[model samples]
Target: RDLNALGGLAKLMPFTAIFTLIAALSIAGTPPFNGFMSKWMIYQSTFLSGNGLLVFFGVMALFISAATLASFIKFYTTAFGGEPTKLTQNVKEVSSSMLIAKGFLASLCLLLGLIPALILPLLLSPGKALANVDLSGLITT
Candidate 1:
């Protein structure tokens, strides 16, 4: 899609705009979001692996995160930040069913971010059991 063709839908489609913003921020790995939690775990694992290649991967991940943040900023501004273009001016908010689904997912993202400990064990358990390792202690340290 042409970025130039989309602009300023926040007023026209407030719900859609907001959900899109949340999705963008989550994808960008900003703090207090699930994306950041996942990336944090990844960085920690890579750094703690004691392997040169893994450490390098952590650095690359940092760079990629930054790039993702910048790109999303531009996208959100163009699509929902500024004044709506002709193509977007008449667009309506998504259906209630879709909104409910997006809202549920957004809430889960916030819940996972706000209380990551609640989900962390469930995530780490299978890995620990399969590898027969004390990954929890490694993560805490």
Candidate 2:
């Protein structure tokens, strides 16, 4: 929580830093990432409804996404950039098993981002099951 106490960890724990970077960027809703796609789908549905109130909320969601990006940028640059502070100077990378786990999760994130169609049907299953909505049109490349 105290970012002021952290610095230059990327040099000490390069692998961990990379994984954290992926997590940060994905959550920040950067393009071609799952986070962005999820938001896009919600915003698309909201705007398509042509309701002013939902449109306003959708715009607010975009602003929130920007704020998320800014916050994560601060998080990455402060924790991974600059000279190491006393607290982070002796930090070490995690075990190989942990790295493997992180790598698997990171790959999944990238996959979902790059190929949303792969999961869109699975994700929309409940909606289809309940309402039998024709959601095939909502699927985007």
Candidate 3:
């Protein structure tokens, strides 16, 4: 369906709207999503670094994060609010394969957030080998 021509999110496509909402929440760094965990780690590391400039930038990041959430909320509400437009009146849900693909990605986001340790080691391996450093020793877990 041509979502660009749709008047409201409800009118566009249900499944697509739901998925978009989830993705938007993730991007906004809401809790229980991968984005939140990653952002939290970034802020934590920046604070622990003991660098004044980094701390300032971290604070700026927080502000930007808030702005991002607000902007996305506005966008979502505006796009999904109101009634259907002429072009979107006959819009239908996306195909099953597409939904399955999106679902997999969304679930992956949640899984990574819930158990980052599962993939952290693999992610660090390349960097560890390149630097000839045992980065695993730095992380207690």
How many clashing residue pairs appear in each of the predictions shown? 2, 0, 1
Writing each residue's lDDT as its tens digit, candidate 2 over 11-41 gives: 9989889888888989988877788788888
Q: Give candidate 1 misplaced runs (Cα > 4 Å).
A: none
Which candidate gets the maximum lDDT versus the true structure? Answer: 2
The lDDT, on a scale of 0 to 1, for candidate 2 is 0.87
All candidates in order of lDDT, best leading:
2, 1, 3
lDDT of 1 at 82: 79
Candidate 3: residue 127 lDDT (0-100): 73
Native-to-model Cα distance after best TM-score fit, residue 116 in candidate 1, in Å: 0.8
Query: Rank by TM-score, descending?
Result: 2, 1, 3
Q: Given candidate 3, what's the lDDT at residue 13?
A: 73
Sum up the clashes in candidate 1. 2
Tens digits of lDDT, candidate 1, 102-125: 988888787787778888888899
lDDT of 1 at 121: 83
lDDT of each: 0.86, 0.87, 0.76
Please list the residue runs of candidate 3 whose C-alpha ends up more than 4 Å from where it truly belongs after superposition: 1-5, 130-141
For residue 59, model 1's alpha carbon misses the true position, in angstroms, by 0.4
Model 3 TM-score, 2 decimals: 0.80
